[model samples]
Target: MNYKDPSLPTAARVDDLVARMTLREKAGLLFHTIWFAPPPGAETAESMIDGRHMNHFNVLGGGSPREMAEWHNALQERAAATRLGIPVTFSTDPRHSFSSNPGASMMAGAFSQWPEPPGLAAIGSAELVRKFADIARREYVAVGIRVALHPQIDLVTEPRWSRANGTFGQDAELTSRLVRAYILGFQGERLGPGGVACMTKHFPGGGPQKDGEDPHFAHGREQVYPGGRFEHHLKPFEAAFDAGTSQIMPYYGMPVGTEHEEVGFGFNKGVITGLLRERYSFDGIVCTDWGLITDAFIMGQEMPARAWGVEHLTPAERMLKAIEAGVDQFGGEACPDLLVELVEDGRISTARLDESVRRVLREKFTLGLFDAPFVDPDAAEEVVGRADFARAGFEAQTASLTLLKNGPLPLADGARVYVEGVDADVAAGYGKVVATPEEADVAVVRLAAPYEHRPGAFEAFFHSGSLAFPAAEIDRITRLQATVPTVVDVYLERPAVFPEIAEGAVAVVADYGASDRALLDVLFGRAEPQGRLPYELPRSMAAVEASPSDVPGGTADPLYPFGHGLTS
Candidate 1:
């Protein structure tokens, strides 16, 4: 396969392929995986095994589009049977929409189903979030996905945080101008050939947590900044490192009592080498925040205990404290032979594995993947599911519909509407869709609460040290919002109070996923809600058990706060 010389300079062809690799090919270029297992007696053995052994790290998920081009041609035939053939970047996580993580669910069966990220920041279009990240980078590089763990700009000020529907709501100047127009529409005007890279994630901000839970187990591993406003979560990660983002992951909470570093921010070296590589000069690739070096298990159970303030350190001491807290990589299913047993026990340093294998081979040589590392599985059926990308995911689910209250919302067009709790064919296209709510002139409920992954009880359901909700489904939506003029809505990927269906509705919308014709085009006014409350709405679980589990503000209050939202 004729080599080198493609007019050098992707950091000198990744430092001359890291001076011709070896150290298990530079620890298999710092581990990453996404699919490809089928070997031991083939025929998809429980979807290509995971009993752990020949493991790499990252491993992409969220299928279809000919199963992501047959799992990227079986992850490039297992990186051409590793041994320096390299090629296997892959990555992914936000497979284009409706996020609630079934390992990055992407199936509206062929991508392009936007409106989630608080409905693209309630449709305050940065050119429609860069045309939905350029049609999700042309359906993820037509099915080989070169790297985009996602645009999780994180700053929906914590409402019981179950991945606040992949944030972009609670304004920081409109999430710093739509996270720099979604990293210039998924790394285009650069980052080598046909772009993708982009990894912009959890970094210095993973919303305040603590009371908003989620640190992926261990009671949502603390991150309170109180009114210290935690440096306003590092201003949209310094506007996503001045909109160049080639990589950065950082989360796994633990900013306890702030001023940074109480451990976890991938073992904080004052937050990744004192605030993202020496005061934001970035220099790409940071990673780490997927099973932060072990002791985490889901669906197989065993997690619980980390409200920050480190304690259970083992996964080879969190992989030598995340490579002396600089971390170049190590995500999900970790075990790059514990980074080749901490570089054969001298405890890391082969010039720190050649500076994280030269920033993971300069992001696989700025993602040209050495000039195309395979893709055409029949042009993934003409660019994976393109009905104008589901009509631009139903016009970003009708401009992220919000409408908090409109008295008797635009109902009058042939009204006999009573549509409660969705699905009578998504509420018979908005009118005369009765199915009892005491049958009649306007009720329409449509709620959503379905993510019960107990995984043998993830420390009694991911913490604010004990979140709740499910009193017989909030007493069956407070007995169908006491019979009539209802219009509830909810679907808030996390954050629960419901205060008896918000003091018995006449209006209450909230969203993060909508598409029953964008919930009946914001229930009849034909789309005008402009979604807002991207996290705060507490108003009782006794104001979330009288606040302060380590800051989430006091007096709880909230029946909506983080950028409120409502505009007829």
Candidate 2:
């Protein structure tokens, strides 16, 4: 049991643990499947930990802070009594955002809520990014979650890309700076039992998808760089490696017309091995993006395996290709049986399996899981979502407001305010609440920019397609402006076509994602609009259509350029 001793070197401990594990035990280490943290009656902690023999899991659908903490402690206690007593490592998607795409990320429930990643970039402060990450780290560790499946370093070059809200804007240099601070905050100077190790994701960048479609579906599988700027996307990832990220996830998009193989990054040896492993010398765990070997059921709908170019291959063949491509783990998959069969059939050597097992074991030891794995449920309740943490997040929410039009902003006190898309109960404190725009002295209207609706339950969560506002909606807003001197606050998740609204309204304010209270604070002179535009707003849909997919900034004249903000 020398591996159980904390005094031993991590390498020595990893070597001992891997040497003693059975083929099934080793195979379990290579798969990280999704597990609902809330225990929805179908799956229990025993089935996931002991029956499946899984040590690593990507947790989904969490509950209140205390409820999550108690569940984590109970789960950890169960693992501690099992044979060899290996601790579980729970990973999660970004959980502090307003965007509630179940497939992409979680909503901020009981956790402190802030604007999305683009909002952080809009503020353009590396120190602030670090502080937010550190706060997130504390909240995560409080609930026994030790892995962050985030700090998505993908550049937001393509305006129509659905995942751009998760990125640090389109500038490579700025993304790099923030990426470094983010890693440092989560993992600290060195990882330990208490730290939440960051998994920097969608390696070599996921931007520049053809026509801004995601690679999660068949129609959106191809990623092309028509502007010959493929290398431009990789700058942030290079910085991520320099900052010493614990894990990496390759995107599912297959490169088209590039020097590397025309296959998904998980299945592409040139990209995964030549570029990432050999050229970059990254020795960390490389977990392939979810569902490469099997079809996945997300939110009650079955979707095809994101095998892309390797779809013609069998499930077993796809898994083998991923192993050959130098990936150490399979995400969102639980078929350790296939890996065991592949070894027995001589398709893959046991030595290859051992390579991955060693890396997996090393991470567990580096995390100090073997020495001290269980957490205090009582302590978890006290630390998560405390008053001070919520204050910082609210302040960040206020700081992220971008004032596109400053005319009549920081509105004078005691005016009758008519609000839309904001709670009337909340707005009543600032000014007299009116029933209609006509009754009000000034109208404050908030609207989320339109996106072309996609089919299916899961796809709807991801806001994709056109960034243009419909003609009918535009006409309604302009008509309202004509009737009253309106202040238009638009949630710019995808940079909406809003030139008409910008020109018609008395004032225009752009927000990535902000609560009603935060918006009111900026409007009523309680706080300043510190955020600038992280990405450009296209002048028209024609300009967006003509723009290169890989380049930063707009192709034609932008209605509002990057870093556009006004002070009162």
| Strongest candidate by TM-score | 2
Candidate topping lDDT: 2
Local accuracy of candidate 1 as per-residue lDDT tens digits, 159-278: 556666777855677888998888888887677667788878888888777766677766567777666777777888898788888888888888777676687688878889988889
Q: Estimate each model's TM-score.
A: 0.38, 0.98
> Which pairs clash in the backbone of model 2?
none
Candidate 2 is scored at a TM of: 0.98
How does candidate 1 score on lDDT? 0.68
Give each prediction's root-mean-square deviation over alpha carbons: 18.3, 1.3
Q: lDDT of candidate 2?
A: 0.86
The residue-by-residue lDDT of candidate 2 on 34-123, one tens digit each, is: 888675442566666676677788889898777887777677777787787888888999998788886678888878888888889888
- The pairs that clash in candidate 1 are 33-59, 34-59, 34-60, 218-305, 403-529
